[model samples]
Target: MYWRTREELSLENRLRRSYYELLRDELDQFIMAHALKESYENFKNNNVAYPFVERKELKPRARIPKDEFSLHNSFLVIFVEDTIPQAYKKYIRFFDVNKTTKTNLLRSKTLSLGPDFDRSQKFLDSVHFYHFLKELLPVDYALLIQRDTSHAKTKHRYYLSHFHVRIDWPISEAAEDLARYLRYISKDVYEKGEKYAEDVQKKFFEYHALPDMIGGRRTAASVAAQYLRRLPFISTVYVSSSESRSLYRYCEQGVSRMVLMRLTTGEMEQVADRNNMPVRELKRFYMLDQNGRGGIFLFRVTYGHTAPAMPPEDGKLREIKPELFWITVKYQHLLPLPGIWEHPPLRVNLIYT
Candidate 1:
């Protein structure tokens, strides 16, 4: 028998188990309500079973894992697999380097403008606005295509639009990883000072930070909790790099304060195990509040896909897809004592599922 220590058992795994348990019962009721068993028997005897619902070996690629650990952190695999068309593969490779280089240079120049520059403020404002709009739009991917035709006598144009597509996986890890990649790419642009660096920064910032800014830290936690409540079996939400800073700061102030004042070493270890990280490792600190309500906050947000708006129609019901993005929050607490202190167990109270 495989035995998992309490610390080894991830919250995501537990949640996945819970989710499946719930889903199994629901599926059974659905089968019973539709007389699926009887219908299946009849079809087997009469050769009338609908092919759509017939049991078939699921292709390995078609199935999604119910637990978070099995989920890939980044959507690169799926994006390369699903969204990239066969015809564009060559073109994508050709433009990959130059496009990346240009985007990086642009970002660096904008950030170089010192903190007080109007251009920087405008850049931040634009980022916030885009994020606001993103919340209203539902999209799976945003593609950016740029082509230049000046080389040919006929002025043939070649352009490639960057595509930002949503990862359909329900696991937060997928989104978190995607967000981190976006930020990493943007940071490169920030360093390079490319022509489109400003635009890239705006987009990256919007995709990763706007949600928390709009709703506040508490609201973000609530959102995460709601996802947890939906588990039919076992599921766990993994906070990404993007979310770590803010959430850690928030939790330290809100919950860690209480825990640190009273909890013993054994209790602290238990909490660390529950969080799936070592107690000592979690004790490092980064940010500090003036009042010392929370100390040592180190967090970063990762960016994922932000969908573009759809064309409007006169009569048809227009469905706007919610912009799907993911963020991960990581934190290490610092105590006023001689040594740093780890955060206590967090009891996230979800508002509405």
Candidate 2:
């Protein structure tokens, strides 16, 4: 073949570069269109992470990780939002009392609205709400705490909060129990004409059931866990334990947790044994002897049969702690393990905070 002139070759190279650039632009457009369409579908489906996907500051196009959603266990999951005391009136859909209850709430001088409602907010913030609901529901439950921003991207950064609770009860049982309690409260209000009806409603808060996804294949807790895992700092994913059968076996065999608690030295020992940890290890981990009852702690325990227990090498436990610095730093206390507290026979209740 004849050698082309350098000018010809230069022109050819320029043409090739332009062609590739045009192809790249078209490919980018195709991907962008597909992504936007997917996001719209997600929004329509009420996916919690949909609104935040398009924010420029949050580059992450929120997508649930498959591994994160691998908890196949059946449980009832409920979501509660906008239940803060200051925002409860504005966001009435959460726990709207009847007209009578409202008027009663206003006239009841015995009920201290300020401290009572503020306690509600504190209950949620400190995760005591999880324990409170677990007791009310009377089931072993796991709580996934996330900031309000995790649900949607708005002007507000972190002034509000929301959470998901996974109860060990069957969905049908949970639904029935909730309905029964609601009915009981309504009947009590009508018959007794109690002044504390408003207080009961306030403390009860409000929650809606989240059904299973994919034709009952994917659990509600799994779906919520997946979505929350997308934002590490703003979420706490339940790490399931290998020895979960112990709790189930306890349920079946009528094991006395009170006896188990009695076997331990003190409250700390009770928590430690409940978590399958030795008291000495628990004390060392929390520095209980040094810090006393009220000090900074990093206690973590896993429940459920999702994964095998893999203890980290000595001196490296902190590395695997949940990425919830915003909460852990402020709270500075151990969250009660639900399985331990939910058992009715347990005389020594775990610390709520």
Candidate 3:
């Protein structure tokens, strides 16, 4: 995720991408909607519904909507509950004046008025608001509005840019080819029912965008993509949840975290169906071991391919297969990425279909 300004590539109009950030915010919502729909019978009006912000002016107003309309914008939520509940109490202070001194040590404070005060000028009601939003975002627009991450960027206008990725030495075709083949084999190991399937759907089904392609700036999807920029640029194929926890523990032992990345969002949206006090904001970060230079740097090179890679001898290998790259790191490599294989999605041509 940490890169010099020049290393980043332009995916579309403005956003650059890394492999980890597979799903965009809108697509995340769409995927959540579809995922929840499968088990809608168990959901309740309160369990899934929440207030959503529609406008930002004086005392912003929010519209409460159904469960589907309230899904959080997170591409990755399986390992952890992407949504967090936070409470904030707002108060207006009133100072009491003393009769003699005209000053007071005590003050009275009261909670402010509840949200649901005003409506967006664009919509008549919550139903109308969501209907308008749903219609405004066509399925095709949501899917094709931008592109997904890819190693080859020039050919695919929508593919995420990746020149920032660094490797210590020259890469070979055999290594790349073997990686693809192994990734194919590993599919059976990862196909662990619902969780794996959902991740696959998001990895392949959802669309990705360069920050600029959407708003000339980085969005949640574009930022989430940075997680791939960590020491291990390779896919998390070999590392299970427990393995990753171990890596974190190791990183914590005396490895002074130098904030290599920081993400900030100006907007906040209500996160729950209850009082609309605690809202969600999009933020991401990358903490590098500033201490790594003195200890040692381990270049964890693994043959990683998410999709099958064709042989370079094949005419369309480059077109259909993913390219190989290195993910050098600051400390001893964690989670053995078997030298056998690991990678990212194919170019847009085969990916979307």
lDDT string, candidate 3, 15-87, tens digits: 3333223323233333323322222322333475322121110010111122223232211111111111112
Per-residue lDDT of model 2, residues 179-295, tens digit only: 233343333332333333432222121121111121121233333333322221122122221111001101111111000011124666666666676766655543322323432
Candidate 2 lDDT at 251 equals 14
**Model 2 Cα displacement at 27 (Å)?**
47
Name model 2 segments beyond 4 Å from true.
Answer: 1-131, 136-144, 148-218, 232-234, 239-353
TM-score of each: 0.18, 0.21, 0.18
Q: Which window of 10 residues has the lowest lDDT sum in candidate 3? A: 237-246
Give a tens-digit lDDT track for model 1, residues 107-216.
Answer: 53312333333322111123342232222112112222222333554222222223232222222332333223333332234343443344333333233333222322
What candidate 1 gets wrong by more than 4 Å, as runs, is 1-98, 101-281, 284-353
Q: After superposition, how far is residue 348 of candidate 2 from its true place, in Å?
A: 27
